[model samples]
Target: MNQLNVSEFIATSDFRRFHFLLLIIGFFCVIFDGYDTAVFGAILPSMMKEWHLTAVEAGALGSYSLFGMLFGAFTFGVLADRYGRKRMVAVTVILFSLFTALGGIAPGPKVFGFFRFMAGLGLGGILPNAIALLTDYSPKKTRTTITAIVFCGYCLGGMLSPFIGILAIGNYGWRIVLWVGALPLIFLPLAYRYMPESSFILLREGRREELLAVLARINPARKIDAEVRLYEEHDVSTRVPLAGLFGEGRALSTVMFTAAIFFHLILGYGLINWLPKLMLEAGFSMNSSLMFLIVLQCGAIVGTVVMGYAGDHYSLKRILVGMYLLGSVTMVLFALNRNATLAYVLIAVAGVPVVGAMNLVQVYISQFYPAFVRSTAMGFSSSVGRVGGMLGPLLAGWLVDMSFSIHSMFFAFAIPGVLSAISISAVQHRYSTDRSRKGQAEVGMRLAGEVEK
Candidate 1:
């Protein structure tokens, strides 16, 4: 492939526009991901009644999608590391958008489940790659905040789903909602045309010219010093085996982070998957239940923005743990409430902390690993968490079928939230110490090099 020309890349307006443009693209991609993921839940009752499906079968549809996400997160994550972040992101979006659109034409639950699985694959792949892409280009000081902003797109998309369901599904059908899920395809072409490959990838590949071009695009105002070429390390390999995450010094942190993710996703997905049904059981009308879900997601959007800012200024660990703990408490309150206003308030409060912590978890994971292994770490953690996500709905379905009160289900999910908060708190303490050591090591290396010179 021909290398990008640094001078030409810097001179164009496209270079100056690239960062914000990529952020916009990332935002839209995540929005679609949220829409497609939540569609099944939003219209599950309609689908069940129309298809004469059992609760177990309807629950399988959700699990199948998450199963696909498990595979997609690992497979595409490795692909992003070996190939490139931009390419994989483009491929994932196209795959998801196409499959999501295909879901509109399913003849039965099985077929719908299959298409949703495929869409989940695309959904799974997009998130890690998108996080990696944003982190690669973002300024170090603002990395976590930028990631939180991108994650807010998911909440924003979720908040819009109930409105879409009430307006479109009521008028047309659930099929219209499925078809609208494909609207994300509009962003695929834009991603292909404008999204640049990550500078870190180019640096690892020893493509100095390409790295310079990407840097120029990211910051056109800064003049590149002639002697300050991209650091070329020939020993760097992008191919990181999944097993490497647990090898030697990396094992404990890896396992802890994975466990934290598992609990976080379990609570997050469980609540999201069952919130509407829970509301209905709590005596809300169908419209009221759906409206409450929308309010919950709106709280999530606001919480993500606030927590993102907080995560940057304070410790990510403190913010994440606090949120999860608050979520657990609010969930209990939500389950006990019967008053309409109180129920809505509790549910919205529960949603606020849950999603904000989820956003921080993504940001923290991305920061924990180095660039070459970053996507792989993201994939592994996400894949493990997806297992919990898959189980959440299935377990809830089983509990509901057993005639357990909705309050019991909420209490069960709350246990995972408490555990996850503890895990994150521990990991945070470790990461703080490790970061300090690494900083000292870097200073020592610099000092030794200067003395030798």
Candidate 2:
């Protein structure tokens, strides 16, 4: 009687064509996610002028979508765990893509804000599912690296925002740029057709035929007897109640993780949402200000790659602690430097730590909790972190309305860096759900024996 444990098989699976395909799927999803988030920032200047909206009003509009995201994370993040990751991901992509297109054609600010809020729900839902999906299948040795590479597409999409704003708005106005949000609908069919459903969900439901199909695709060369049985190694811990997130010596780290994410996002959303407007106020042309966002995202791409590699090699916790502190310095320099040329360079440098911190932390959270609760953990943190995401823009608008100096604008941005550093510094690493290297190595060995039965 041949038997296979799904966890052991996935942990030991080689990185092959199948894994690379999955990487492409994850990368494209993140790119659209980035594009959707950065779109508001890119269009804000144009939208403000055309709509004659005040900074405070514009900021409130921005928070509407983030508010929807807060709920989406709380709702879909948990639903994915129950309904199926692929299905929930598909549903989210549709919700955001179709509604954002509606937002583009809206005649008034109120309607646009309404549509965007609807899109935000889908936008917010994608991350937990994407992170959960990638982590479930990626080789343990390369998991962090792979996740970083995929999520960096967020910055890649951000890099395109300014260029799209320049071209689309110049030709067809802001609505054209927004209309582009629906392009993901075209990408959906291909993904739905190729992407495999989560094995854990399948196993829990006892979907034998589907599991067999996925197992064959995951390891095409490995022989599987027609009657091979599938099972999970029973662990008392895996069966624990969801409350285990706060129990089992994990309560402190949970709070710290939520706090770190909150502070990081305050810096992240505040910067992305307001950078162009702040630059315009600082006396640059609209085009020049938009270009700064490109530099920032390019810097983010560089940061994402570097941090992912570094975190894989060093302690992710320690690296994050240092990165937040460095972000404070970069943000301050970027804010005070009036020279457009120098500002571009400084802002780009700022994106590395600020944007990179966002990607790496999501990767960390996906790893921090066990698979049973992984999606819920990510959802809860994001749902809470989104409060910062929601308030960052609103607060920035208030600062602008108060007529704070550009330097003060970023100085507000910087204080959170220290707070974030303090928060992440407190997380206890001994409780991380990630398996140790030696244990993972043993899982790899066990695969060979199990396949021969």
Whole-model alpha-carbon lDDT for candidate 2 = 0.83
lDDT of 1 by residue, 116-233 (tens): 8998898899889998888766665566777888998988878777778888877788888778877767757756787878655665566766666667667768676645533321
Top model number, lDDT: 2
In candidate 1, the residue pairs with backbone N, CA or C atoms under 3 Å apart (3 or more residues apart, or in different chains) clash, namely none
Candidate 1 has an lDDT of: 0.75
Clash count (model 1, backbone only): 0
TM-score, each model? 0.90, 0.93
**Candidate 2 C-alpha lDDT tens digits along 1-453:** 777777668878888888899999989988888888888999999999999999999999999889889989868877877677899889888988888789788999999999989999998899889888988888777888899999899899887777799778877898888888899999899998988887777776667788778878788998778778776432212243246468657899888988988888888988899988998998988888898889889988888888898877888898888889999998778667767688878887888778988888888888877665677778888888899998899999999999999988887898888999999999997878764434545676332211221
Model 2 stretches with alpha carbons more than 4 Å out: 225-227, 233-244, 436-453
